[model samples]
Target: MTMIVRDFRPADAEAVAAARRSAFPYLVTTAETVTWEVAGAPAERQYRLLVAEVDGQVVGSSEIGVFHESEEPGLAFANTSVRTDTLGRGVGSALVTAAEEWLAGLGAAKIFAWTVEAPHAVTFAERRGYRRGRSSRVQRLDLTTAALPPLDPHGLPDGVELRTAADFLNDPRPLYEADVECTEDEPDDVPAGRLPYDQWITLTWEHPSLDRELTTVAVVDGTVAAYSVAHTDGRGSYWSGMTGTLRAFRGRGLAKLAKNDALHRARAAGCREAFTGNDGDNQPMLAINKWFGYEPAVTEWRYVRELAA
Candidate 1:
């Protein structure tokens, strides 16, 4: 079987989505979401999507782009996913090579990729000059049977109330502000400080996979203090898109309240599986997941490599 890599064409939506699902079962991917992602990419992101084919079948894919939202320039990302059955056929390497050169041309000073915790993944990165870094656990909860702990019933404390993302249909800047605050404090050591409301509107709220109804937000004094944006594929699978509280609202349990509301809505809507990922260093979020009865499903070690100057 001859394996080759190339750019994704419009007609390859179903095949590309299928390949991604086969390679990363933990994700919630749909043809429409994939198409929207490719078409709606911002110019500053330097985004380019690619696919690897073997005997005319797409066996792998890579979403390569700069983290334009990061405070620093030239930091890029190139995540490659290959169907498990098609591994060892050189598809991953080919995709990586193409992605690296493309990103380098965009003036990317450093490139980061995620490799599963398995030995082959480590070997692959090390041999390619990428060094390992902090890891994150991908967790799953069988919602049908998992028992959740008693939520803090302070009823939001004073003038705070909990609502779904749909409530922000008319104005999403509140959610954007909450997101910016929480993201700046997320586990990744790399600095990310972009908070332009217009940019947030374009990149997040307008995302195709976002299930606004399943997303929950905590509003206090007419301000979005925290939120948990949920992602769904119009399927039974659910993913925690982002769960964060504004710095001023951290210890008030707003994050828990928002996520609990999301999970409740998800379960009511027949979602069977729930998934979330957190950096190993983020003990607070890990504890929160534990309270929800989630367990480790998989792990991915972060890797970074510098190109020759």
Candidate 2:
């Protein structure tokens, strides 16, 4: 069957969402998130969310655009996915090829994408001239029966405290600072230094999916030291957005404390499953998450192809 590439329409939201769910079950997704992403993309992003339809059924999608968050220019991405049951019918290739042609036309000089660590995905990327880069390891926690570590008083030094993100309602700048510090130090080939507060407010704070009250923060001597920002589908699925400790406050188990607090709150709020991603090289965070009873779910690899000539 010939796969026909076309731009997704408003009516195709449900099918696109189903395709995404089939492709990436680990994520907390919905038709609304898919629709919101395409409709609300900023002008500079030059984003295009396309779908591949075969026999009048949407079987694949490609979210292609420049990484607007990055400081560099001409660096674009085309992450394509085919529905689990639809992979061998040329749908995936057609969607990817269409996205590539669109991005190349948009003057994208370098394309970066992420594919699951499955052999077929890795092989497909390599054949298309993409070289492997950084990776994100997805971890899953069985929240229902997790025997969580007790919050030890002695584990934290004196003058330290833990709080939820709600405490920062009046002033979230401290949380913002902590985020900037940790994000700067995060292990990534794409280095985003000193993320601005305005962008943080728009991109992180104002995201439609965040569950601020479930998000936890660690404070030491009246200062924000660490935090775990939580995102939920408002149903049951939960995801950890940013979990890190400030540079001045390492070796204190603050990262674990913050994330644990968030996880506890998440379960209390009726979320039975939790998900988080860590860089392949981040042994410290990996150890921390494993302590929380999170096991490996899948590995996703970032791939890059230089269009710079």
Q: List model 1 lDDT by residue over 54-141, tens digit each.
A: 9998878899998887888778888888888888889999999999999888888889898788877789899999988889899999
| Backbone Cα, N, C clashes tallied per candidate | 0, 0
**Candidate 1 structure, TM-score to reference:** 0.94
The prediction achieving the highest TM-score against the true structure is: 1
User: What's the TM-score of each model vs. the native?
Assistant: 0.94, 0.92
Off by over 4 Å in 1: 150-156
Model 2, range 97-196, lDDT digits (tens) per residue? Answer: 8888889999888898989999889999999889999999999998888888766756566887888887887888998888888888888766454666
Q: Which stretches of candidate 2 lie over 4 Å from their true place?
A: 152-157
Q: In order, what is each prediction's RMSD in angstroms?
A: 1.8, 2.1
